[model samples]
Every structure is written in structure tokens, then in C-alpha cells.
Target: MTDSSSNTQETDSSQYSVLNVNDWSENWQAGKIGFHKDIEHPLLVKYADKLTGGKSAQKILIPLCGKSMDIKWIADQGHTVVGVEAVEQAVLEFFTEQNIEYSKETLTDIPGDVYKSSDGRISVYRCDVFDFNRSYKDKFDAVYDRAALVAINRDDRERYATLMKSLSAPGSRMVIVTVNYDPALHPGPPHYVEEELIPKLYGNRYNVEILERSDSLEERWREKGLTYFDEVVHFLSDKS
Candidate 1:
């Protein structure tokens, strides 16, 4: 007896696949995503003023750009929007949901595809954010960081800041919105991003502005069993 039952269980475990980056990519290929937001986030709406003042048609970069509606809102204002997402399925669904026909192409520097509209009005790079440094240095005029900062474990945040700084130009502007919480109870991608740390990382190269901070997050959070969260918004500009 070759333990056939045990072999069958192992095969079944493999049947559901794994959640590695590639598995996440295949999930996009299969169109299964639940992390996407159906509407443009309120943070974008409430703080639009902090993000708006600039040359017309500025190129904006959105990192870890899940299928958020912010891309359409920004692009509709005549600005070019470029987003980088690690999940290929989310990238494909974003274009499909928007009803914008696009062509798929590979990024020369990273193992990912580019989904671009025919007119180049909107484009999203399906790749890891870290890979952009080699090909995308000084490429964006502004960066909109929503959820990207908190979505990763805190161990990598410093690297995240460094990569973001590298991709932006001198005098570039970025709006970073993150929520704060206690790590002891609320293990996160809801990870606690302390407000005092921006200057420690980017202060040498950028001017940091504390645009807004409040404890009045939406009421739904408390119901989710997280009792504490502080909404924080920052306006970052390169001082060069």
C-alpha cells in the first residue's frame, strides 16, 4: 500500500493553489478579487485640494494600485495616471470594469505587463513597486499613496519610502493617507504607521507638511471590532 489516501490529500491541497505573488497573479487571470473598492475613496475627495494645485496635465503615480476608482477620477481631470500593481488580475479587471479597451505589453525592466489605453490616457504597470527603480527613476510629478503604506507589514516601510522617493522628481508632490492603530490587538495591513516618522525617512530630501489629522474616522470601523484609528494625511514635496 503506497498510502494512496495521504497522496490524495496532498493533491487536493495543491488543487486550491497557493497565495504566492504568482498565485495572486493567476487570481487576476481568473478574475477573483475582493480587496477592490467599488467607489473612489473619501480621503481622495476630502483632501482633493491638497493634491490639486499643480501644472495642468501632471503625471500622477499610484502605487500598489488595487482596483480603486481613484484612477478614473484623476484621469478624468486631464491628468495622466500611471499605476503599479503586483496583482495582474486586478490590473486586468480595472481596465475591463472601466470599459476601456487596452493592449497588454511587458515592462522591459520587470516581469510584468503594461495595460495601456490606445490613447495613453490611462496605464497601469502590473509589477512589484520595488522593480520600478531601475526604469522609472524621476518619472512621476506626483504620487497618491492610499492604503499602500498600511497594506504592508511595518518591517518594509522604510524600504517603501526609499523606493517612492527614488521614483519621484525634484519638486514633486505626493499625498500619503494612512490610518494609525495599536499593533498588539489589530495585526495589520491595517498596520500602525506613526505620523512622526516621515521626516526621519524623507526629511533629508523632502519638505513634509502635516495637512490633516483626525480621530473621526467613519463609524463602521468601531463595528469591525477595531476601537481606535486616527486618520492622517500628509503633503510631501521634494525641496530640491
Candidate 2:
């Protein structure tokens, strides 16, 4: 899943149901990914230093990554990049499109496979993000969450946030991009995440900072009758 740039028309909240793995695969197969961007997200480019700290070889994690070009961009910085995506098609497309040679291995502990770049700088776990857990505790030095949080079911956000915490090392950092819009206008995979919710979710362990908030309502959202939309970026650091 990408951001709020969905090609489908907005519908009533009741018409939208929480999507499952098969549903996501169907979306990919049907080419319904207007949310996917051809270029790396600008916010990620602008605020990358917050995560990388100008250091090389940092271990970075991307959850719910959908063949994002940012994966390659981050790896090119001489860091190790790990991404978790549930769709096999998306994962395959990433390696093929990027022209990166890779090897795939079936994971012993999980139901999915891991795809690793020939250079060993990038690895993508093809599995449900929730199933990826503490076996890799304190593994990541930083995380780039461009669309992961906003793409999940609202009911699963707490679990998702907890998982993020567990996967990160002490003093780790994260950058997240979220969207806010009237749910009544468009119930979403890119759901309305209130600004207040971030601190509530991670305040206990991480220092939270709002990096940017912009009026990012695209023409499609405006046409869907959304009076306003705000795209927000947040930086979070573990209070170690």
C-alpha cells in the first residue's frame, strides 16, 4: 500500500472493509495501486538524515514496504536495508525493476521467504508484518515508515506500534509519514490518523516530534468531497 493517492473513488466507510493478505495481492494483480509512486517520496529524501544521522552502514527497517524505490536509495547510502512486504508480486517486481540480482530463501521459522540482494545490503521479508517479531530485537538502528502505519487496519495500530518498538534497538530512531482527512468523506486504507495519536502510542518509550504538517489534499481527495487533508511527518527516538 502507498499513501492517499488511491485511484479508486472514495466510498462510504461502511463500504470499506479491512483488507487482508489476499485482498492486497488482488490489488496488485488488478493493477489498482494508484498509491504507488514512481519516485522516492520527497519527505523521505528531505528528512533521511534524521534516521541515518549521517552515518553509513546503519541497519534500517521498512515495514509494509511495497517495492518502494526508497529501499534502493537507502541501500545505496552504504547501509543495510530490510523491508517487510506481504505481496510476492511486489517483492519480485522490486528486484526485477531495480535490476538487482537476488537470491530467495524459505524461512524456517516463518511461513514466508526472504529475498536478499547479491551485495547483501538489501533484504526483503515476504510475510505479514505482524508475524515478523522479536527474534530480531534491537536489530534496526533506524526505521523509515512512509506508509506502513496509515495502511493498516485501525484496530491493529497498537499491535503494530508495539512491534515496531520491539524490533528497534535502544536509542533507535524512526521517521513516519501519515495523513489526516475526514473519515466521513473517505474511509481509508490511508485512514485519518489524528496528530494526537502518535504520542499516545509511543510516548512511553520514544520522544516524539512533529516534523511537518502540510495541506496535502490532492485533487482526487478534494473531488471526493474532503474539505481538507493534512500530510504529517513525525520523528521518533527511543528514550534510552
Candidate 3:
């Protein structure tokens, strides 16, 4: 007979499905993520000044920041880095992989543990994205989106944009890296967000610019029986 524990594990893995904090926790437990990179994204390095509005020190927000190396890169540049992620496992991995010491606490008005750096430059709140409180509105000087946007399903894109815009301080800047592709050819968690949708999403409140586009990941997608992510970067600024 097949092991009952194995069957239960498989069922939980697919059932939660990244829709909430519990789901992402399961995702990490199963090691299903392949999008993680140990190095800072080249696009972020190229446009760091633009993202921070040429400021060396600014408060930055990164959503869905899995154990990605980009956070370490930005923090090392002398800016405060605040990231929100759903999985505690991923948060721990970040500290472990980067060799940074952190302490965890159960914070009020938030649904998950808050892992904070020893020196206070980095903070990762482990919580469902939507559960973040509105009291944080207009609090960030800049926002960075590498894999955050395309990682979510399409139905939540509007809400995601609205939340990001609400958190912008006056004249705040944002650098969003997204994937665009033929939706029919891929199973997309890194979903295809068409170019036209950017304006519909953030144009009303922020000035938008298309900075770069590439097919560097095209071959990787083809290997997976799909086309490509067709990576694109966009720069956005608050109108106010």
C-alpha cells in the first residue's frame, strides 16, 4: 500500500496553491520554486539610481520577496529594505544564505512573524500580501518589483497595483520587472502581463516608462515546453 503520509503530503502541496500564507509555506516545504536566484538581478543593478530617484538612502519595499539575493544587494547599498513574504521558511533561508543574523517576533496587527535584521536595515514580514494593514499607506520612498508582479495570478493584478500605489510617498519611484509572453504557451505563475495593461494598472497615478526588454530566458522556457518570459522592465513614479 502507498504510504498515507506521502499521499497527504502530495494533497496538501497542490491544495493550498499559493493563494495564501499557508499555501506558500507548503510551496517552500516541497521545494517547488525554481525562480529563485542567488545573485542580484542585472536589471536592478543597472537601474538602481533610477529606482531610488538618485538617492543613496531611501526606504524601499519589495513584495513577495522570496529568499532572493536582490534584497541583500539593495540593503548593502545603504538603504532600508523592507520585504513581505508569506513563507517563514523562505525568510529563514534568506538570513541563512546571506549569513545575516536575524531575530523573529510575533507582531500585532499583522498575521505572521516579523524577521528583523540585527542592525535594523532589513525587515521581512512573513504574512499574506493582502493582510498588510492600511496604516502603512504612503510610507515607502521607493518600491522594487523583480519577480513580484508576474509571480501572482492575473486576477489579483489590479489589487496588487493599487496596494503598491497606495504605499508610495510623494514622487516615489518604482522599478518593476515583469514577464510578457503568449499566455497560451505556458503555465504561468510568472504570468504574461501584456504591455498594454501597465497603463491600465498604474498610468492614472504614476508616470510609466518602458525601460528594457529581452528574450534572455527564451531558451529556458522552450525547455519547459513553453515559449519565453520575454522579460520587460518598467519605471514608474508617483504623479504627486
CA lDDT, every model vs. true structure: 0.73, 0.86, 0.80
Total backbone collisions for each predicted model? 1, 0, 0
Question: What lDDT tens digits, residue by residue, belong to model 1 across residues 91-159?
Answer: 877888988889998778767788898778788888877776665655788889987876654556799
lDDT of 1 at 195: 77
Q: What digit string (tens of lDDT, one per residue) describes model 2 on residues 30-148?
A: 89776778888888888989988777789999999998999999999899999999999999999999999999998878789999999999999999998877224447999899878
**TM-score head-to-head 1 vs 3, winner:** 3
- Give RMSD (Å) of candidate 1 vs. truth: 7.7
TM-scores of all candidate predictions against the true structure:
0.81, 0.90, 0.88
Best model number under TM-score = 2
Stretches of candidate 1 exceeding 4 Å from the true structure: 1-35, 214-220
List all candidate RMSDs to the true structure. Answer: 7.7, 4.2, 5.5
Q: Model 3, 168-205: lDDT tens per residue?
A: 78889899988876665554567667787888899998
Error of 3 at 16 (Å): 16
Quote the positional error of residue 176 for candidate 2 in Å. 0.8
**Which numbered prediction scores highest in lDDT against the true structure?**
2
Model 1: per-residue Cα lDDT at residue 67? 81
